[model samples]
Target: MLLANLMAFMLFGFDKRRAVRGMARIRERTLLLWALAGGGGGAPGAFAARRLFRHKTRKRPFVRWLWLIAAAQALVLAGWAMI
Candidate 1:
């Protein structure tokens, strides 16, 4: 989980920096994959990344997908807790 969040954090920061430089961008799909891989519980790493970098917060589709991933992670956590 720690590694997943760290990966998301770095990737998001790198993407934001590239955007500022008008350089090539990381794909949205890749970013979301890291978020989904945020491992087992709580909010996806992208949430922290967004807060820290102000990245993608204004993109409606991306935000929606992030939330969806969070919901799925939360569900998994809940199921685990039930055991």
Candidate 2:
């Protein structure tokens, strides 16, 4: 999770010009996996990156929702694990 967050932060902090494009599908799916693997914050980090970088923010609704759902799932998983 911490690692995922770190990667997320890296993904966000980097400039879009340095970003890897033409891989929206792959990147989105990868982010989803990271979120599912206990990296909930990664989703939002990606979203914020997209907004800040203005890259692929409005490309695919499905991927966006997938990230949202992944974040939510991670929250639930964490909550459940806490108890």
Candidate 3:
């Protein structure tokens, strides 16, 4: 989880930099996949950076899906804990 978060954070930061330079952007699905694979903590930081950088803020799908993914992960964890 720690390693995944670090990777996700770097990916987000890198994506933000790329956006500023008008370079090819990272795919939203890639970011979501990282978050789903235990990088939820870093995912929020990515979204924050996107907002701060004025990148992808208008994309409703990314924001909505990430929120859903986080919520689903939380519910799954809670369910597991209750077992």
**Index of the highest-TM-score prediction:** 1
lDDT of 3 by residue, 1-83 (tens): 66556666667778879888999988988877776676234555555556666666777988888778778777777887899
Give per-model TM-scores: 0.91, 0.51, 0.76
Stretches of candidate 1 exceeding 4 Å from the true structure: 41-43
Report the Cα lDDT for residue 22, model 3: 95
Ranking by lDDT: 1, 3, 2
Q: Which window of ten consecutive residues has the lowest lDDT sum in model 1?
A: 36-45
lDDT values, one for every candidate: 0.83, 0.58, 0.71
Sort by TM-score, best first: what order? 1, 3, 2
Q: Of the candidates shown, which would achieve the greatest lDDT relative to the real structure? A: 1
Each candidate's number of clashing pairs is 0, 0, 0
lDDT tens digits, residue span 42-63, model 2:
5655556566767656557746
